[model samples]
Target: MAAHKIAHASYRGPSVVKEILYGISLGLLAGGLWKMHHWNNQRRTREFYDLLEKGEISVVVEEE
Candidate 1:
């Protein structure tokens, strides 16, 4: 008796439009995250400065 061989279909990679869309979406997500981080940092800095101005926070410096 002869052994039977199994054949499988090969997979085709993603199309150009799919790849382009993926790249665009990834770029947008990265930009959004960067913007969020920048906004948060600015907000925190502003609050810290406000606290300092209001005497709610103190800083000490010593001469060496």
Candidate 2:
């Protein structure tokens, strides 16, 4: 039977500022995307509702 030896790993210093900056950047990107999606959805909803209100289009709802 052969025995295996495990090697020890070295520790590196941590950078708090770098981690914070990365988190902030990620948050900003996510927030911008969320805002863009929200704006687009709202615009579409408003347009559809406006069309409905103006009687420009008709919807047929079937009851089951």
Candidate 3:
């Protein structure tokens, strides 16, 4: 309708630069979090194996 055109005649959305920056920021945050999570899991696994080697932990297995 003509009313819809008149209402949005002067409306502007976000800039391209703003959109690019937002996307880059989001990507960096996600990548950093994923890296940290992977690093932590590796560290825990390493520590667990070291403890196991030192005989501080035990593993139980049963034969069927």
- lDDT of the structure predicted as candidate 3: 0.91
Off by over 4 Å in 2: 1-11, 61-64
Better of 1 and 3 by lDDT: 1
Off by over 4 Å in 3: 1-9, 61-64
Give the total clashing residue pairs for model 2: 0
Sequence-dependent TM-score of model 1: 0.72
Backbone collision tally, model 1: 0
Clashes of each: 0, 0, 0
lDDT of 1 by residue, 1-64 (tens): 9998889888898799999999999999999999999999999999999999998788876569
Angstrom error at residue 48, model 1 = 0.3
- Write model 3 residue lDDT over 1-64, tens digit each, in one string: 4545344466588799999999999999999999999999999999999999998887966479
Candidate 1: segments with Cα more than 4 A from true spot: 1-13, 61-64
